[model samples]
Target: MHTNTSTLAASAVDRLRQEIFDGQLPPGTRLAEAAEAKRLGVSRVPVREAFAALERDGLLEFTETGRTVVKQLTPQDFEELFAMRLLLEPAAARSAFPLSRKQQQLLSDNISATRKANSLNEVTRLDLDFHQLIVEASGNTRLLKLWRSLRTELELWLGYLHQQHRDRELDTRVDTAGSHEGILDCFQNRSAAACEKLTREHILSWREWLPMAELET
Candidate 1:
């Protein structure tokens, strides 16, 4: 019974997360537990558990009024998130330096699939796969764990951002995969400096387009 309850809670979490990410539940929108429980066809227990999980994931927060609202990211949140990525990802790329030939091809293929990903979710999955591969290559257990934590937060935030980025015509050509092939080529050729440089530039470039104005809305 305990296991079943946990499974149900996880399912409720995923459904709520998708609703939030797809903008059905926008930032600052209050979530009532009874309403969500009814909507998700689960008991209040699981709904409450899922709310706790989402709060930890940074997608939801409890208010002073004892209500839960979708989290509203502040400018500081955005700045810290990107700044951390800038420091960690480039360092990971530099240390993931000597990836074996097999790892190289795998990362290369991940980038290729990113180019053809049709939906924002698919794009996000491929993007994470590509970068996580680099982090795994670093073979640093600590960095791998940190990267996973970052990925959870990134997944929550980037899913919405990437969808918006793809919707705009001018940004349409600026695929996340654009700098990937170059990065892989540099890594494979053992040009560690160039790989690190390309990775850093790509990370910086993506942040330049994040929808900062959304924080107000």
Candidate 2:
């Protein structure tokens, strides 16, 4: 019974997370444990668990009146998060050089998958995973933890950006793959400095892709 409950909670988390990410449950949307449990055909126990997990992920927040609602991201949120990314990711990527064979393979596989991904959601997920693998390869426990803490928010932002691009009929496959290929080449060549420089440049360039004007809408 305990195992079943745990499974249900994990499933609820995935469902709720995808809904939130897909904009089905947009920011500021009220969420009730009872209603969500009914909708997911699970008991309130699992829904409560899911709620706690999402709150930890920075996707759910309680209002002054104690009503739980989806967190509304602001332009400032993006700026602040990207600022931290600029600090954390490049440093991590710098140290990630001379990666283990396993790490290299995983990153290579991720980029290939991203290139072939049919859905924007898949591409966003793989894109984030590519960065995550670099940070993990750095072998710094604290740095990995810090990066994981920001991952969900970064994912939400990237997903939004991808959707905006799609709406504008932009195909990002080439640019995204091209950037990763360059970084991977640096890794292949064992140039840590080049990797760091390219990684920083890659991240900094996202400011151009940021959907600043769409934040209010």
Q: Could you tell me every candidate's TM-score relative to the true structure? A: 0.90, 0.91
Q: Candidate 2 on 92-183: residue-level lDDT in tens?
A: 98899888888888988988987888888777888889999999999999999999999998888777666655763235776777788788
Please name the candidate that would achieve the greatest TM-score relative to the true structure.
2
Quantify all predictions' global Cα lDDT against the true fold: 0.79, 0.85
Give the CA lDDT, 0 to 100, for residue 42 in model 2: 95
- TM accuracy, model 2: 0.91
How many steric clashes between backbone atoms does each model show?
Answer: 0, 0
Best by lDDT: 2
List candidate 1 stretches off by more than 4 Å. 169-174, 210-217
Per-residue lDDT tens digits for candidate 1, residues 1-217, read 8898899999999998888777688778899999988988889999999999999888999988799999885656777778888988888898888789999989878887877776777777777788899989988889888878777667766766655555552243246676677788888776777778888998898676455435443
Question: Residue 162 in model 2: shift from native, Å?
Answer: 2.1
